[model samples]
Target: MNEFVYHPSGKYLFVATGQGRVEIFKMPELELVRTVAAHSGQSNCVALAVSPDGKRVAVGASDALCFIWSIHETICERNLGRLDYHVRAVAFTYDSQLIATGSEDHCIDIAYVNDGSRVHEIRLEGEVYSAAWHPQQLILALHPRVILVNETVSVYDYLATPVESDLRNKNAHIHCCAYMETFRNDSKYPN
Candidate 1:
């Protein structure tokens, strides 16, 4: 199983495989949450990003499409159609208002979290290997190679289109992400 992204909440981590399924695992305790059939074929669950607030997740699989799933209630809440380009990395802006995705397409696309509406697309000269939202700043990352990127964990304000951002970027990847609040405050909650 190829675990792509571990959300800040720590309540869930996304595991992708060539098996065509994106599996969610409740963290720390390593509890199994649910497995969503992520793509149409056995495409590698190559890239994934979770919204700020922990209510939604965006995963890339099966071609160049990214699907946004609501984790609040589960059961396939909504589908953000084919993104057209094959994404190599993805991240959410602080406040969760926008999402930044980087691709071999050499473009970074930012979209409204609620409607998948394109906000801005930044062109990268080289293929982006990974990306993330800056935890406290408006700047978004495109495959950040640094080891300790300090950013905010993603959460959501669920509404009309589905979700909204809290505007936090936490420097974390699929395996290292842990809810900042939980670790900082020692909260029992998922954070």
Candidate 2:
């Protein structure tokens, strides 16, 4: 398995494998329940994310596509078409209405989860390694594969507009990002 995530319900574990398959396992027992082929040609499943609502799982593969799997049915729900290069990261919005996929193509494409229609496309300065949505809002933070000069994680508003100056982090390569809780709209920290 290349990447694995526990469902938000804590009842199942989703594992993405090098064989382009997603293995679903029952929690506590760790018993394998089912396996769904996520990609063709044995392309490595590089990234995986379970929606916060626990209804779906998104798997990104070296095939340059992202597949949304049904948690209840254990099936390939929908696929976000070819992304141009190996998909490196996948993330779901706070409400699970959208999914964001980051690829080596230097693009973060946000698509609606309901029908797999693209909502927005965010082009980055470098290859994106990770992406995370704000806990209570449509905001997203992306960590690109950085050179020393562009080490900061880029934050964007709901419209995919860059807002890096609003929330700045310096002096470290942000391998990943997450929100422990919701952020308040205030003078210093506005959501």
Candidate 3:
């Protein structure tokens, strides 16, 4: 498997595989639930994300397409189809209203979850390695060489700020980043 993400409800685990498929497993015993043939041409599925609402899963593939599936039905709900290269990162907004797909083409495409209509496109300086949405906010954090926060989807601009002076100066490469859910200041570590 290339990547796996647990459902927000902890009931299911979704895994991306090199064989162009996604395997869904039930928690506890990890019983295999379903296997989805996700991509044509047998292109690998590289990344995936579960929506905060626990109703959807987005899987990114080397075929340059991201497939959004309904959690309950286990069916392809929509396809975010405009990306030009292998998609490496996928994220859903805090409210589950939007999704962001980052690819090797040096861009992040933001689209509406309901209709799969694209809302904005963010052109970055390099191939986007990872992306995450702030757990309680609209901000989006990106990586590899830059840290960008999207102020708002309506604005269509990113605050291109570096996380640290040393990282910026030394050209440190960040492969991934995530915003932990601390809804009530519960803990600093991931659950």
Candidate 4:
């Protein structure tokens, strides 16, 4: 398996495999529930994401496509189609209305979850290694060489000015970033 993600409800676990399969397993006992042939050919699934509501999942594959599946039905509901490059990361907004995908093409694509409609796109300076949505805000945190927070998806560098000094000369390459749920209620880590 390349990637696996537990449902927000902790009832199910979704596993993405190199053989283009997405397997669903029950939690705790870890019993097999269902298997979905997510991709075709020799392409492998590299990333998996579950919606906040635990009703949907998004699978990213090396075939340059992202497939969204229903958690209850175990069926592919929507295909994100081919991107400019292979997908490296996938994330769903807190409301489960939008999905954010990062690719090796150095771009992040945001799309509507219900209809697979393109909402917005952001091109970064380097390949996007990871992406995460704020737990209580509309901001999106993207990791390339430096951590960037996209506020409202319109401004690319909304928080850049405040953290410019710390980011300078750091030359850090972040593989992934996640917002702590408890931090949302804390004042110290305001989003």
lDDT of 2 by residue, 1-191 (tens): 78888999898888888878888899999999888888885698999999999888899999888989887787888899748888888999888987889988867887778888666577665687788877877767776664433123344433453234422222212122321122244456433
Q: State each candidate's clash count.
A: 30, 0, 0, 0
The full ranking of all candidates by TM-score, starting with the best, is 2, 3, 4, 1
Candidate 3 lDDT over 30-69, as tens digits, reads 9998988877747999999999999999999999999999
lDDT of 1 by residue, 1-191 (tens): 64467787666778877756788888888788787877766576677878777777877754777767787766454444535666667677767767766666756666777877665555544455676666876655444222222334442221112213423333322111212221223334333
Give stretches of model 4 more than 4 Å off.
145-191
Residue-level error in angstroms, candidate 4, position 128: 1.2
TM-score of each: 0.67, 0.77, 0.75, 0.74
Among all candidates shown, the one with the greatest TM-score: 2
lDDT of each: 0.60, 0.76, 0.77, 0.75
With a 3 Å backbone cut-off (N, CA, C), the pairs that clash in candidate 2 are none
Rank all candidate structures by their lDDT, best first, as comma-separated numbers.
Answer: 3, 2, 4, 1
Name the 10 consecutive residues with the lowest summed lDDT in model 2.
172-181
Stretches of candidate 3 off by over 4 Å are 145-191
Greater-TM-score candidate between 3 and 4: 3
TM-score, model 2 to reference: 0.77
